[model samples]
Target: MPGMPKPIRLLSSQLVDQIAAGEVVERPASVAKELIENSLDAGARRIEIDLEQGGVKLLRIRDDGHGIPVEELALALARHATSKIGGLADLEAVASLGFRGEALPSIASVSRLTLTSRAAGAERAWQVRVDGEGRVGEPQPAAHPTGTTVEVRDLFFNVPARRKFLRTEKTELGHLEQVVQRMALVRPDVALRLTHAGRGLLDLPAAADPPGIERRLEALLGAAFLEHALRLDAAAVGLRLHGWLVRPAFSRSQADRQFFFVNGRAVRDRLVTHAVRQAFQDVLHQARHPAYLLYLELPAGLVDVNVHPAKHEVRFREGRQVHDFIFRTLQRRLAEGGLAGTEAEPGAPSPTIDQRPLVGGAPPPAGTPRQAAMPLRLGDERAGYRFSFAAQRPPAARADAAPPPVAEESTAEGGALPPLGLAIGQLSGIYVLAQAEDGLVIVDMHAAHERIGYERLKAAWAAGRVTSQPLLVPVVVAVSAAEVALVETHQALLQGLGLAVDPLGRDRVAVRAIPALLQGADAERLLRDLLADLAVHGDAGRIAAEIDRVLATLACHRAVRAHHRLGLEEMNALLRDMERTARADQCNHGRPTWVRLTQQDLDRLFSRGR
Candidate 1:
């Protein structure tokens, strides 16, 4: 019994390296990610890439950075041999992206690899080679500049099975280009040149300033991104978040435009995704995706960068804190600046306003559209905003809605104009038309009221925790086994959302209680939907979002419906509310609540500006 067979033995260096290659080199994209990261970490301001046959036959990367020294050329290919990290301390707070030093060796073990490098002020450049068997070649003098060149050939040649699993040429190139694109986005100051099969794919110059960076973004992400993007700069505690968030009105059908970097390294972390997704939850529709290029900076010690071999995933020491910070920061930006946040262009024609003289301060003649309207006035711009009663009330009352009448406030001469302008008349019984300082303001009555109502509902709900009612008879919903487990495991989180979910059987959950607001609602369907959201997004962070959806549903029902005729006072009242409501530009569904067309735009449409 004491003599157990020993299976432990030292694996050959080649075999051990091949095993590392298995995890580090999945395909051409994997190879590109590691190589580009190394170039960036070396302080390279410019990088050049060339690939052929989808990088299966050849992959070459050259960088203008401090390269490997002649003496260290051979050592560069050895596993775990790196000048990046010296000890456990350096490992704890890795500042460079290539501290692990596994990329070179792991790649060499799977492909024919060569590295030629010359550090700054070196007498001459040097080159080292490694074959598929992981055998290192002696260093030799090579003609080169103050930079590095790495060439990989015949990827996965040693393992025919792995080579066979690669996708088609176009598919692989797409993945490889995505890798380059992601890296290119992260380092705007770095000039990157990419070529595939001798054809130039991407040529981007280095940007040294913010405007230049914006130009680069426009080129890469497209002009739409710049037109719709809102610059975000916010810091709290020890974390700083700064970048561009596309307006919700410009959400994408797919998530291809979302690029997030943690301390300059591009990452796809769940905590970050969850936080951003949650922030845009209410504003964006279910099928739509928010587009953003967000960058976060914090002390390295608070984050673990070595969690994934590819470095695409990171572990934040304070996950919930980071999540909350990201959510609150982005949420605040969206609230402060509604859709189309930019102001009117400079050097435009001086505004021309029309005024209607009032006799006896009488109410505007019924059914007679007025030529004058009040422009948007400055007020408290925070989320908890409300309009002055004077902006809504008139000298006389309207049966449609009730507000105290005011005689002096009827004319723009009495006070400042409102930001949304004063409503002139309703169009097609749907849109409320208004005249602003420099342009025309068109408001969708239903969408405007829906957002205003939704905000109020949320404010009221936040004032007091959600009210829940116990179901007299528990409603059992049929669900998959996993859903049942979800309800059982997250019982506390569900309870926090005013849902008491208990597993009924192998594939069912009994909802014993639901939020009071959703009492008469379909409890079974809501529970099932909540379970589905949890499965896809994970955790209690999205539970509040579930509550928001229910609120939005209620708000939609109570909001003014299209085709509902309204008096001039009623229209003005809605406009006044929109000027102060949170996220007033868009409804709960992310559809724009209002739109503006400058006077010049109208002139152009009618060829009056020619």
Candidate 2:
């Protein structure tokens, strides 16, 4: 009898509400998120939040949205009571941010809460109070504006275990600020103000115009992000995605700056992340994450937002279609940014180069086996500065070999200068300096050449020009029956990628041939990885990525290296090639290939105005 378990019994309402609180409220940040979402759903254009002790002691939120009538003040604090949805059909196509209606009761169960509101046509405001014991008091007359105000005090005060789990005041406040930031990003049309212990922390006005949006971005994400970011506005197949994507050069070390919202609700979806990562595969470093603030607008019925209690994730009805759309749109936009003489997006102003002095040196003495410093000067005495450097010339081009022929359009003297301009000289045998119509262009020869080569190789591969080499001995791999079926079904697709495989038995496949570029790769391992990718993504992206990786390696090896001296004609040819290549702005390794310094930048460097 002592070891026997207690009889089964129904849990009390207070206990059930507290249990629900565990899922809805993780900390102060969670509370803020839920409350703010409710305010947004109520059509509040301006909301104010005041926190004390990182919202553990007090959280007061005021919103000028449609308020609840006096009759519903008590019902508003009841679990599962909400105006957002009515029945199962409404739940299936939820449009509001807060539909579960558990937030108020769950939060009130953990702390003392006061709710005050005045309906649209109400003559007076009504107030209701709920204690930690889940006791709802009768409504009483109160003084308030024509909206609603929710005040939560002593969070987790009744639950010592949850209270002790809270982090430091500063740490909790930081989390709260991030929640506010996310809200501000998603609802740029809503005004938001946050305060901590009577001190203003964030104040963002509604941004309705382009300039206002840019200013808001600069204030929230910093001037550097706004300067380096590209505008994106793309729509297809009943879906619309618009936002800013930072260039590769401005990629973040962490994913802190990545924000994706679905129907105005911020979420972390695997399908979206995978698509974005694949889009940046060729131009971004593996260790870095692309920074973007993208908002996706689709019909509410097309996505299920009830997957999670916090609604931090969503499941699309057509997952594959959504993934492909996001990938193609971003990839095309990035490629367009590489075009010559064009900014990332049309009508978007080009970013001004930071003011900085250019420092370089003359070549070392001819036939000097050992390197030594040498000084060179540019401009008049007032604007000139001495430069020094030492290095050995790279192999490839001879000093007296004739320069390659240039196109007539490129070399025409009377015509306008090309986007990259005319090559002036080689600097330190590593950079190519050019004179442009409006400024100076400095190109990293090695990096630029690598990108050009990679793009060409990709083009050739895409055109079915990549040859296949039969393996000396067919490599057989044992896999699942499902994988075997997959291999046989996708054989045609595989053959197009220069991969030839035949099913040997129910669970075995033999790889007969592979791409010529991947001749020495481990055939069995490669096939396994390819199969895994196809099974997951249902596409040839895996094989394509593999081929691209090998092609990138070959390009990097054959590209011009540092310390390579080039004739003016050769430099000009290279620049023209860069102008014609896709994704030429960055090398295969995600490094910038060139930079522009306008005449204004030069003036600033020389203190001309001062």
Candidate 3:
């Protein structure tokens, strides 16, 4: 008797529905999401939601969409009955928000559901009722407009286990409000209203233009986010991405402000998250998350949205392509804007720099500010004091040569001034103060120089100018079979990053050469870290990031120290270089290099505005 096996049996239809409900209907918020998506799929332009007791007791949704006919009212409550798709081919390319058809039957199995609808040209409305026992009632005559209204009461009434899991009224309401907010953000052309316990919570009108969308964003995400956000619209191949990205300075400690939508459906994808993190890694502080509202659109056939019952995750056919595209687009945008472009105050004019060469050129046409000749040397042995701008300045100039004379440009009449203005003086031998057209500019000399040097080094490394240093004896390191395979597969990529690694055996690798710039570093540790990154992301970004980190450290040490004294000419040269460098707003360690104090801010500080 103890060794006997139990007989196999098929679950009842009602029990099967309830089991499916466990996946699709997790809570009241889940119910709201399904119903709202259904309304949108029905081409509803105006929808209203009413809830009581956080939707555990009563939940009602009314939509001005073409509803079902009386003859189909009974079938709508049946299992596997859907008008959204027909065959397997339609399943592969599902464009609608919902198509599984399980939402109604599954929901009906766990609660009381009433469906009322009136066709476009029907003489009257029809209503059908279903309970948690899977019993359906016949369609009956009802008084209603030319639309549909779904009323669900006593959620999980029969399934006490599931009902017990529901949280308090306030917590459930919060989750439900988030669902409504996500829906409202995606469809700017749809008007949505939400009321809880007879109290109006939200009313969003349809937005028709860009300005209207901006107003909606402000209302939803707050004015501060919109103020520091950059509008992005990029398209390539068959994929299109558009959204707003907040600058790194305004990043949040938590990821609650990020919203990503794919083909009008809110989803969470690891590929997308990795790409965003890679793009902002160099600029954001540790543990800080970038805030964004990004929308990605591609052909539905290229993505599989049917993998999950909740439809909150999707699988991309070409995940690597998507990742690279996202990373490149954001990286280019950040570089092109530089510091002045994104860090300007909301109402302040963006500072512009003079396009004239800053080093070794003919004199300017009469009245402009004279460009200083300050060359920095950053060779391997010169990690103490001497910095090099050899990449920027002409090769003929020496590192220790004195800079040329500075001809002060008059701002009183008609002279042009760069965006960062002219360096007025130094503060504590650390900060370089400058006077601009609208206000004052403060620059941290050490941080600013570190960023400038780091960018140049990265450019040099990317251009294949960084040579590799061969070890006297190859360093052998033990690793897993997967790590060895990674090394073999990415041999060429590793070579490009100045890391020469080859599989020594089934579970080991030999590192023969490292980046000449990082000659004395630990090759074994670096290779292990790189293998870990490759195992996770399946890309060369980790190796590159590792090299960049070492390069950043070198630049930080070689950069001018805080206590170093400099004349106005030297400070002005540093300021001009910052204007041309990418990501100059923050140093390699994600600290701001400069800040601006507007005249209004100064007036407020002095109580003059009062």
Best by TM-score: 2
Off by over 4 Å in 3: 1-3, 338-416, 469-480, 518-525, 600-610
lDDT of each: 0.78, 0.80, 0.79
* Model 1: per-residue Cα lDDT over 1-610, one tens digit each: 6898899899999988888888889999999989998999888999999999999999999998999888888888989998889988988888888778899999999999999999998999999899778778899999999999999999999989889899999999999998888887888889999998999999999987766776787678765566555666778999998777776766878899899999888899988998898889899998999989888999999899999887889999988789889999988877755422323224311112222222232332322222221233224543332334434445464434323333233424434445566666677778887666556778889998999999999999988876679999999888898888888788878877788888878987788998887668788777767877678656554447667888899999999998786765777789778877767767899887876666765776677846
Best-fitting candidate, scored by lDDT: 2
Model 3 lDDT at residue 518:
76
* Model 2 per-residue lDDT tens digits across residues 42-153: 8999999999999999999999999899999999899999999999999989999999999999999999999999998889999999978989999999999888999999
Better of 1 and 3 by TM-score: 3
lDDT of 3 at 8: 98
Model 1 pairs in collision? 375-418, 376-418, 376-419, 377-417, 377-418, 377-419
- TM-score of each candidate structure, all chains considered together: 0.82, 0.87, 0.84
- By TM-score: ranked, best first: 2, 3, 1
Ten residues in sequence with the least summed lDDT for candidate 2: 371-380
Local error of candidate 1 at 66, Å?
1.0
**Model 3, range 336-454, lDDT digits (tens) per residue?**
44343333334322223221211222322322221111122112122122222222223453433323224444242245445666766677778888777656777889999998999
